[model samples]
Target: MGLGAGPPAVKRRSFTRASVAVAVAVGLVLAGACGGGGGDGDGDGDGDGSLSVGVLLPGGGASRFGQFDGPLIEKQLKRLCPDCPAPTIAATSDPAVQRQQLESMITRRVDVLVLAAVDPQLLRPSVEAAHRAGIPVVAYDRLAQGPISGYVTFDGTTVGRLQGEALLKAMGTKARGGQIVMMNGATTDPNAGWFKRGALSVLQGKVKIGKSYDTVGWRPENAFVNMTRAIAALGAGDIDGVLAANDSLAGAVVAALNAAEVRPLPPITGQDADLAGVRRIVRGDQYMTVYKPFEPAATAAAKMAVALGRGRTVGSIATGTVDSATTKNIPAVLLPSVPVTVGNIKGTLVKDGMYTIDQICTPALRSACAKAGLTR
Candidate 1:
């Protein structure tokens, strides 16, 4: 945070999300569906006054949830359903644990489920089980398969394009002859494919990829090991840039570069404007990160869940639609992302209150921050 700026404002009852929920409930009820509160708290069948929402998050590999997703989601849920019993959220970092958690939520019979699956396709059967039980599922973030009613996510293709463009810009004169190592996300998560395809579309023919590896679970450690291997295979100096899929991978890649004793690390790209990524940007450890404003994505998910819970149409909420493997015409809200570098750190993340200069530029990084003109 900034020197005098206090902790970020993250509160449970601070958001304004109930109008859409209430209105949807009222509308559906008038239209002959016994909408709003199924006694299970989905507000789907009858206005029973309680909602049990199980939020099955994917992992702890990234800090997005601990920092932003959890509180924002909780706050939105509570604001949307004030008098209803507080919504229940079962959060776990492990996929196997998440599977058990999913079964538990199924056993508990949560009214509505918002999940960001670790393995989207692997969770299909579990999602189908909830569907079998007539529970409405809102596929959050990862877009788990099966009979999902709604979806919310940032545009992966757009994110990849941003990464590619930034990598090229960072490479400067080396852009054409640049030999970048691709540290991509797992093949299991379909979004990884989406991101990779977008990056390849922009990067192909323009740059030569020396070596690439899919880091399972988007693990920083895995990326670190892979980066080490890449360095050994293709001399550290030959690699020009790194197309790290997200911030965590970029962290691993940078650490590997330091270990290899590469004087000035090549320009590396990442997604998720993680604090670590931001700090890396300020310190020039990493080149750029895709700053996806999670609030808008969270807001869209909140609206979709509330609407689906209330049995209302999503016409007002849907920004556009997307197609999944099994489901087509899936009503979705895709938010755009931006590229953040040292040049615009203050204007981008600082101005948006995502991070503060103080939180970023510690005594160790003060000089670098000044060099980047991040200090006022």
Candidate 2:
């Protein structure tokens, strides 16, 4: 779950013009079904001496799922296998829908599958089916519960530890005995439990947990509703801080606090350097967010998928191994996550090109941007 000390910092690399062009072309081919399915029947092969990759993301609305992961993976795949048919991508929040999509890809007899399971356990049967069909599955972001050949994701427990440590720092003196609310991700996502465990490891003796809730579907509305309940039960003034699992939930928690008219909002922790989350940090609404460089993770997954499809070993690409509920010693590339506060906006997001000053510092955010030293 936790990768102990953070991984050595990776030097960010820029894509060449030719690779960018190919990525754009691949993007066009997979346009329509950004949150659904694409490609034709029985993808056994692209019929052009090329392999077909099936990518199933766990729905949109999280920002990263569609905006970052999907496109990044597409680009990396194209760059790696120029002749391969553009990957078939599908996105859904429902496990049943994901299962059906997986089955459809299996029926198409795709060469390989890159899946970010909606519910790891519920999708086991589909993964098994893919395995039986001789299609290697690369579990993306979340570890799926079947015979996955490889995994690509940030260290889950480390993500939690970063959030917890940031929360403690933001809370300052109050952290010694402050009562905080934990707004964790969906129970169906194994990463959610791992995150909670890591956070508890750092927070248990340091602070009192006033309330904790596992959001359903990792939906912001669900988080909003849960935050409202926590406020009602604990009283707004009694809560010291909020430990939100990700940026979406952080937004929901912030909204609930605003709705309750809780003055001088408490420090809130989040993961995923989402634009809104970064904006929140600039405005002093959110204390910090974890930034997991997605390009490298996407590149690793793309390489693994393509290699597996070609019957090549992935030992060189995998940095480590992880155990799923039903599988053990699965090869994995566990990337490190960086803690991004207002102080390091330039070093993290801006430096990595995840966001430019112009993008982050809109007309409305110019003042905050300037104050945060984001002037360009």
Please provide, for model 1 over 267-374, each residue's C-alpha lDDT reduced to its tens digit, 9 standing for 90 to 100: 999888898888888878899998876665665566566666665665445545666666666666555677888898887788777788898888999899899887
Q: Estimate each model's TM-score.
A: 0.85, 0.87
Which pairs in model 2 have colliding backbones?
A: 42-108, 43-108
For model 2, how does the per-residue alpha-carbon lDDT over 1-376 read when each residue is reduced to its tens digit?
2221122222222222122224333333322111111222112222334679999999765578888999989987776666777999999988999999999999999999999989887888899999999999999998888898988887777788889999999999999999999999887887888788878889999999999998998999999999999999999899999999999999999999999999999999998899999999999999999887777778778877877877766665566677666777787776667788999999778977889998888788889999999987
Instruction: Find the number of clashing residue pairs for candidate 1.
Output: 4
Candidate 2 TM-score, C-alpha based: 0.87
Alpha carbon lDDT at 367, candidate 1: 93
